[model samples]
Target: MSGELRVIATAGHVDHGKSSLIMRMTGMDPDRWAEEKRRGLTIDLGYAWCTLPSGREIGFVDVPGHERFVGNMLAGVGPVQLVLFVVAADEGWKPQSEEHLQILDVLGVAGGVVALTKRDLVDEETLAIATEEVLERIAGTVLAGAPVIPVSAGTGAGVDALVAALDTLLAAAPAPEPARTRLFVDRVFTIKGAGTVATGTLTGGCLSTSQTVEAYPTGRRTRVRGLQTHKHDEAKACPVTRLAANLIGAERDDLARGHVLAEPGSWRPTTVFDVTIRPVRDLERIPSRGAFKVYAGAAEVDAKIRLLDEPFARVRTAQPLVLDVFDRFVVRESGRQRTVGGGTVLDVGPPRAADPRHRSFLARRAAAARGDLPALLIEERGAVRADDVVLLTGGEPPTPHDGWCVAPTVRHAVRDAVHDLLGAFHRLEPLEEGAPLGVVRQAAGDAARRAGAPRAAGLPDTLLDLLASEGSIVRTSTTVRLATHRVALEERADDVRALLERISGEHEALPPTVKELLRAGTPRDVIDAASRAGTVVRLSPDLVVAPSLVDRAVALVHQHAADGITVSTLREALGTSRKFAVPLAEWLDAQGITRRRGDVRFPRED
Candidate 1:
């Protein structure tokens, strides 16, 4: 919910006073390893905490100075909130300093402070020249508009200003986010008093004394016996908090920095995953289409980086894929090197396809690495769902099948997909009125969930409206199917190919029973079909088709074609063999469809 945690790391060449500045600021030495002090260079990452004047707590990480520890430096740089690019006033910017800067830039460090150390060793003119050079070097970057402050841990000159600068920045800086929780084991050891304690940055989500955190890659779970941040007990520890969790029944030596700590069900293990990755600068040979180890959370695995677009890229990672894949989503393995770029998993198993739009997305992502979209990636991906952006950006979006970037969210596709099924049910004959929700879901595809059934949040309410508007479906409370797909059947009895028209025409003299009316003699199938067709009217069975041949024949007998007909003579026109003459008399009587008075038949008034 908050922005990001402020975890600053010190990166400077050997003898740049990186350690000394940290010690003076926090009144504590960052050289925790004895080997580091003896060698007069930072050997491993030493963590310290700083409380700014605004009362906000920030973590400071001091990485090693020797080139041998560059790997160690890489590990710490990613999780830190910002970089304090330390340069000695006497020595100015050095080689490793540039390397660190490049790494920071590549990792998208948006906020930094250039701490000009050893100020007492340089004169005013020299100091001015050094500051100008550093300024030029930092142009077109996040630190372009930043202030360059000169301070000596030895003299305390500008120390107050540095603290005040940090105080203001800390208050304004974004809070750290924990999408989920990841605790990478840095060092673990058994203690006489605490039993077993593991130390590392509590980088992801909250951890209290009672919560169980998993040792990842190894798949071990342990409870927090105690917690120490900057060597202080913690009820809840969050981003950049240097933590020593005393875990119950844990073997400290067995747990190391490369191993991870995570909350269960929050973190998972996979052998393959879709990721965005970048090569570290200064490596002479770019990786070919080859396999590399990937580490994420606490999981690690080897996977082939099937480079798309080109075998070699001047860009970092080339293409994104939708993959039904699994691997460590963090900690990419490039040949012999280890990179700390992995953080969260966007998807565990995904479909595969080729997508060129993936490249543009990657380009946009690389351009916006230090800006807003890192958070956007996490939000859209719903991967770690934690707060950190730096860790998960390691793997480009996945490129699965023929290598296309698959949209991470499946809800929209599934919603549209089920419309096909609903449409068919609406338009087709003899279906279940409405298609089964299961059929709708299956037709919707794998990525979608359903809504009405309350199981899958598949098909949202809005989409159902879309279907109705398009006439793709029809509804009346219980039924839902395609608008053009529904069918109405035979609604009339005895309606053969052309039987209905003749029956309607001939029966005009007197209404007939629905059964007898259609009789050029209709059958059950014909009647049922006609009934379904809605052609015949089923008047009561009483009034026969030949109402009274006697009355109508008598009436017709007196009439010639030129003369008007009378009802009594029409009945006489047909004798006992009335069947033949009956219909004819009826017809003549009904030139006006006939009229009747008591038992008499007459021609009706036209």
Candidate 2:
């Protein structure tokens, strides 16, 4: 494709020459770990970038096929857009290949170019049979319609065709969506002259130096020391380019395969997963509700399957759970001990506690799939990406046993969740107007689900409209406030009218910033709420002039300057802190009660 971003991986059982084939194809080494080259088989994930015949360079993540290192495989392939399923013609699809392929299918790795390595080891007929067997294994799967080619890593028989096919596949790859930011970390090493450097494909999202970001699971925050994309130093990196970010603060040991670099708060760690999972055909029987090992993203934990309607088991983690699946998840259990068949993630955090007696989750599960899982996860969690959804869901993305519309309902849930939050406010403190939109949105989502809204989208607008119309909503010139609650600095509706009387009379020339008044022991939220209630107007970011005080201040400034109120006059006039003095003058200028011309400030009528 003209502007495509390609991420491919190598898979097959160990000893199938996945590393050698890569070496032949790109002339780049994949065995960086000392033990890997010594063992003569890849025991970890290795990464490289190669240019296709078309001159389009793409990233290739080489993962281990050994059963012990499957977790490592999950991390490498988690972010890839394509796969290079390598099955030696002699060995065919072995345990490692099947497992890795199953993971690819579960992780939703689509568009693969199958390479039948070691073609020289077998007769033409044997090669055909092995190739046929490999095809049959992947048939009806994501790797089903993938292109297959034969090769000899030793003789380079079909290496040329493989590269050509890669070129064609990459040429047809779709352009990476710039809308959602994504980064896949593959290499973390200390530079000889520099410090810690992380190399990976910048799938989406932009990365630049001096930007603040956090490393997940570890909770270590750091700044980008420098950025390099496509082997060239850059001030910032755009999506779809291979990136090597030099990091500051984090020790080299603090980073690992499972560690994710993301925008702060964009991705969180999740325990419970509401997933749509499926049982492999080989399952001797369906698993009952109880503990089973769940593998996702880069982590795996023991979980209990809470099968729904008995259509599928509901998986419960040792802690809070978040992966969701219906009849469609690729779930495999070996006596409820380990997860062998992993499935794609549909929705990360739905209700695992959903009463299996009713068809509630079943009703909305299908919609979540067709609707878009990535969109759904971000909408509900306020997280920025599907990985965050993965973090929220507690696993890699869940593959739907059936289709779903997780996105639309999630958006609907946000509107309702924020609204009902207001209803709660109306009850707890009827005198209080409302809260901020961010807080409200989160509360509403939880409340809506609790109220049997089916999904977030089912929330009613009566709740949302009430918030907006009531002016209960506080807004920064930038952010929305459907959920962030506020209170006035001064008592409202005549609560302790004496305080306002004093502020109005004794301090006519100046006012207090909410922070300063808050020092007197009033809670910040309560102060903000009162301000929004119009008991007091925040004439400036810091300055708060009570409704009763504005008039006297106008009269006094006119008395003192008549011409204008300079900084010194205003400071001397208010006995308040500097925090309030500068802001009070600015507020006066805004009210059309005063205008600042050059160094002198004067009062002016609208």
Candidate 3:
């Protein structure tokens, strides 16, 4: 059986033996810079790996511990699950140790093992006292109850015990599930033959050679030429492990350390985002407005903070970064040069705080557990495309209602609005059988936007069909109406009867014109209502005739079945003038009752 692969990072004060501990355990020095070895300090991030006793392959990210290199430290620890915390036995806990612990706690590192390095420099009693102090300092931190093993990198004593502890901790760590691939580029450089190489901790999903990837901030598309982990070439790289990908189609100058390589179109880059934050350590305040640096993934951005309410705030960056909800971030007061706090991202591309729905949405997010947030977001949105839900929340939509994740309340509201709009349309134009399809779509789209489902604008055809399937509305190929709606001329019955009598009895073959009807005391609406009721047919803007006259016209055309009928022939047959015959012939052709060629007509084959 193969054990799991995991990545762990080291954190402590400057020169606290974090690099030395990794070297002793992994048989490879983590400090890669020549200056680092000569200066006896780790400067930038370093990487090394080793297999544990249980066969689990573990990678170590060695981070700089100096106060000035805290940004580098944050980049290393931001994406990993386990921590190898180092506190010198002689020095116990220092300023950087306190700062590092606070950072780990806020960033939500789930598991840890504290290393009491340089144990050989202190006696047994001093070592015991140092262990006690470290425990007290980390009591309420993420490393609480973590094993503190005393070790000396020079003599290699107790290094075995620390390794065993790490293996045990990793054995209990949750396994990484397959997901969308995201690799924050912590290191970018060029090789002799490789065009450009970017390295970072891989998370979210897997990366394989020849796959297309996109870089954030730059938005450059590139392909992976090759992959490597622990100095060995690999065809694929998995999550929660350090990875270096040789990229094609991009110059080394086009990439940078803070950039990210992800599956094309998998991430959205935004300069502004919302988060729920808590102050770190004894810090009691997070200023509503200030210059701050946000450290997330492998990116550090300058930003301005705005407080919406307690624990809820918005940060607008000077440049864009790829981010997701539930991602952890650390914030440092730019001027003070100290860790202020960190938080979990709640929303990316949030609406203005002044928007009416902003606070209410945040309230629901605050009340939801991490796993429940995606579903809650979909519910709050009313309806969203299933693909969009995955992109926005990094989780699948609860259940797609015909490709849209719909909330019951918002769906009901939209349905009601559709009914109301159709009702208004019927009241205004009672002579029409139903509303035009385009008009109903426009009205339904407005209602959906108001109900919190912006993507449902124009109310997709599928949703319209769904509404019809539920019997909320009746729809034809070109029109829509409420199921309960019907066209009725009962209130205009007397006027309709008068209009029909004038058309059928007074002017049967050549009915009265629209102007003539009005002059003869017939209201225009009554004429229209009679037409809708099938008592009369309006063949033209000015011509109104009884349906019986149309039947007679069709009978006359059939009487000439031996030869195709002409407009002149129909006029003579009906004893009417060419004015009525021309429109009547055209109407027959349009309805496919007759097919016209030039001036003659023939019965349609239908």
Cα TM-score per model: 0.60, 0.61, 0.89
- Candidates' lDDT values, in order? 0.56, 0.62, 0.85
> Between 1 and 3, whose TM-score is larger?
3
Using lDDT, give the best candidate's number: 3
Where in model 3 is the C-alpha error above 4 Å? 1-3, 177-179, 354-357, 378-388, 398-407, 417-470, 474-481, 553-563
Error of 1 at 194 (Å): 1.7
Q: Give the Cα error of residue 202 in candidate 2, in Å.
A: 3.8
**How displaced is residue 239 in candidate 2, in Å?**
3.9
Clash totals in order: 93, 86, 0
Candidate 2 residues 113-150, lDDT tens each?
Answer: 99999999999999999989988999977888778899
Tens digit of per-residue lDDT, candidate 3, span 329-439: 999989888999998888876755435477678777767766776677777676777777777777777767667777666667768877888889889977667888887
Ranking by lDDT: 3, 2, 1
Query: How does candidate 2 score on lDDT?
Result: 0.62
Top TM-score model = 3
Q: Which sections of candidate 2 miss by over 4 Å?
A: 1-4, 177-180, 184-187, 229-231, 240-242, 284-286, 289-292, 310-339, 356-365, 369-606
Give residue 309's lDDT in candidate 2 (0 to 100).
59
Model 3 residue 72 distance off true place after TM-score fit, in angstroms: 0.6
Model 3 has an lDDT value of 0.85
